[model samples]
Each structure stands twice: as C-alpha cells, then as structure tokens.
Target: SAAKKTRTMTTQSSLKDAFSSYADDLNHLNDKREKVVKASRDITANSKKVIFQVHRISKSNKEEVLEKAHKDLAAVVDQYVARLVKELRGSDFWKLRRAYSPGIQEYVEAATLCRFCKSGTLLNLEEMNASLSSLSDPSHKPLQINILDYILGLADLTGELMRLAIGRISDGELEYAQKICTFVREIHRELTLLVPRMDEPYDMKTKMETMLQSVMKIENACFGVHVRKSEYNPLLGSGDPSYPLMGVAGGIDL
Candidate 1:
C-alpha cells in the first residue's frame, strides 16, 4: 500500500508539471500575438499617412508629389512593416494572419496607389512581394501578403481613385478623370472574375459591392464633365475633353 501511494503521488506530480508547461506555452503565444497586433496597428497607421500623402498629387506637382509619396511609403516599409516582418519571420504567418491582415492590406493600398500615380499601371501582387524580398533574410521564408489581403486592398484603391477622379474633373482635367474612370472600370471587371475564387469569398464579396459604388462614382464624375462640356459649347459635341474647364462657364461644377 505504501509503494502504491508513492506511485500515485508521482503521477499526480507529473500531471501538474505537464499542465504548468501548457499554461506557459499558451501565455507565450498570447504575448507574441499581442506584439504582432501592436506592430500591425503601427503599420496600418503609417501606411494611411502614405495614402494621404499620395492624395496630394496635382496636375502641376505630379513629379514632386509622387517623389514625396514614394519616400513616405519607403519609410513605412522600413520602420513599421519591418517590425511585423521580424515578428512573423520563420513562423507560419497564416496562423497570425487575422491579427496582421488589416495592416498588410493598408500597406498594399498605399504602395499600389503610389505606383499607379507614378505610372498609370496596376502593381501586380508578385511585384509587390518582390519589393519586400530585400527586407527578409535568405534563410527564413519571407512574409508575403496573401491574395485575399491584396485583393481587399485593391478594392479599397478604387474608392480613392474615385475621389481623385472627381477632383480631377473639377480641376478641369476631364481627360485625366476619364483615364481614371477607364482604369477603375477595368479593375472592377477583373476583380469580379477573381473575387469568387479567393480564400474568403464572403469578405471579398462585400468589397466588390463597395468597388461597384466607386466605379459608379468615377463614371458619374466623367459623365458629368462631358455633359457640362457639351452644354457649354452646344455645337462642338462634347468639345475638347482636355481643354481647361476655366474656359467653360467659369468652371463647371462636378
């Protein structure tokens, strides 16, 4: 009976030790997740600043505005996104994707916006990931922004472009607004085909609805500009799309 009691106590002791280690492991995981969340918040905040900076682009300051935007975006990558990369390196980022996904999406939005503004072209996902390759060590798998996040960010970009289109139309840059309208329309059409295949189709479905609204906004702005231009010169049949609007009835309202 004495030997049996000793063995029972030893088994109980082992169980306690095992449970204690489990608790420690859980606590460590929670701490790491919290750190990644905090880093994500920083990345999101700085990426937004870059977006706002890009919005400062104008017909005259294209080069200067894009130069500053590029610099600001690079700062976001080096300062805030680097922290996220460090925390997620070697680990399966998919596991913590929910925590960092918002920031990644925002970063994609800012970077793509800057790229599009600099050159009227879409920044492909592979190219975006390639840009980040320099930030990672060769030994560990680099943290790549997954397709879902990239698509979500692209969806958000249309809204900004819509705003830019309205402003460009108001500024008498009807041709620029039309260009933006065409670009956004193409993006929405392509995204419609791709969204169905994305991992989280439900979330992307919501974005696609919002993207449709953005597409309409740009289309409306361009349409309004053409209508106004036509009205101003009844005989010219829409007149010169690129002609400065200041010549059209003291600048038409968008």
Candidate 2:
C-alpha cells in the first residue's frame, strides 16, 4: 500500500510541474504579444504624423515640405518602427501583421508620397524595406515588410494621390494633375486584377472600392481641367497651346 501511494504522489507532482511550466510559457508569450500590440499602436500614431507631414507638400514649397516630412519619417522609424522590429521575431512578423499593418501601411504611404512628389516615381517595396533594414539588429534577420503590407499601403496611397491631384489642379498645375490621374488609374486597374489573388480578399475588396472612388475623383478633376482648358482655348488663344487630351481619354476608359 505505501509503495502504491508513493507512485501516485510522484505522478501528481510531475503533472503539477508540467502545468506550471505551461502556464509560465503562456504568460510570457502573452506579455510578448502585448508589447507588440503596444508597439504597433505607437507605430501607427507616429506613422500617421509622417503621412500628414508628407501631405503638406505643394508645388511651390516642395523641397521644404519634403525636408520636414523626411525628418518626421526618420523619427518615426527611430522611435516607433524600431520598437516593432525589436519585438517581432520570425513567425511573429506574419502572425502579428494585422496588429502592426496599419502603421506599416501608413509608413509606406508617406514614403511613397514623398518619392512621388520628389521624383514622379513610386517608391518600390524593396527600397522601403532597405531603408528599414538599418533599424533592426544585424545579427538577427532584418524585419522586412511583406508583400501584403506593401500592397495594402499602396492602396491607401491612391487616396493621398487623389488629394494631391485635387490640390495640384487648384494650384493651376494641370500637367501634374494629369500625371496623378494617370498614376492612380494605373494603380486601380492593376489592383483590380491583383485583389483576388491576395490572402484575405475582404479588406482588399473594401480598399479597392475606395480606390475606385479616388480614381474617379482624379479623373473628374482632370476632366474638369481639360474641359475648362478646351473651352477657354479659342476665347483666350493665349494660354499654353499644347495641352493634350490624353488624360481625358484615360478617364473615359475608366
């Protein structure tokens, strides 16, 4: 009887130890995820600031607006993005993507906006990640932005581009407005084909709807410009004579 009791106690003790260890591990993981969530919030807030800064750019003060935006973006990477990079590990990058994605997307919006304003080119995802690479430790695999985040960010960028196009048109920069129309139209068309291939089609679908609206807004703005230009051409006969109707043609196709 005593030998049987000793074996029973030993089994109970082993189970207790195992459960305690499991509980501790779960607690640790929960804490880690909480840190990631908080970091994500920080990144989201700071990244929005960067986006706002970039939106301040105008044709006249391009250099000054971008300079300020660049500084704000750098600060965001240093302060908030770095925290995200530190907390996230290999699988955690994808696992916690939803938590951090808004921030990352906002960052992408800002970076690409600045690039477009400065050079009339999209900032590729590779370049955005390359810029982020320095924030992570060299020994650890750098935190690279995945394609999904990049794509989502790009979707949001169309909205900003729409705003920029409207502003440019009001500023009498018709050519710039046309360029934005062309760029947003291309993005909308490409995303229409790409959305179904994405992992979760719902969010992309919603964004695609919004993106279509952005495209329309730019198109309408450009169309208005073209119409005004055409109507005034004969009356004034003094403005630039080479205004092309290419932008209106693209809008009609949409």
**TM-scores for all predictions:** 0.90, 0.89
Residue-by-residue lDDT tens digits, candidate 1, 1-254: 99999999999999999999999988977888898999999999999998888788777777998899899899988888888998887677889999999999999998888888878889999998988887888898877889889989999999888888887766666677778889999999999999779998898899999999989988776677677666767555554544555423334565
TM-score of 1: 0.90
Quote the positional error of residue 236 for candidate 2 in Å. 0.9
Task: Show the colliding residue pairs in model 2.
Answer: none
Q: What is the lDDT for 197 in model 2? A: 93
Using TM-score as the measure, the top candidate is 1
Which ten residues in a row are the worst by lDDT in model 1?
A: 242-251
Which residue segments of model 1 deviate by more than 4 Å? 1-7, 235-242, 246-254
Which sections of candidate 2 miss by over 4 Å? 1-4, 89-91, 238-254
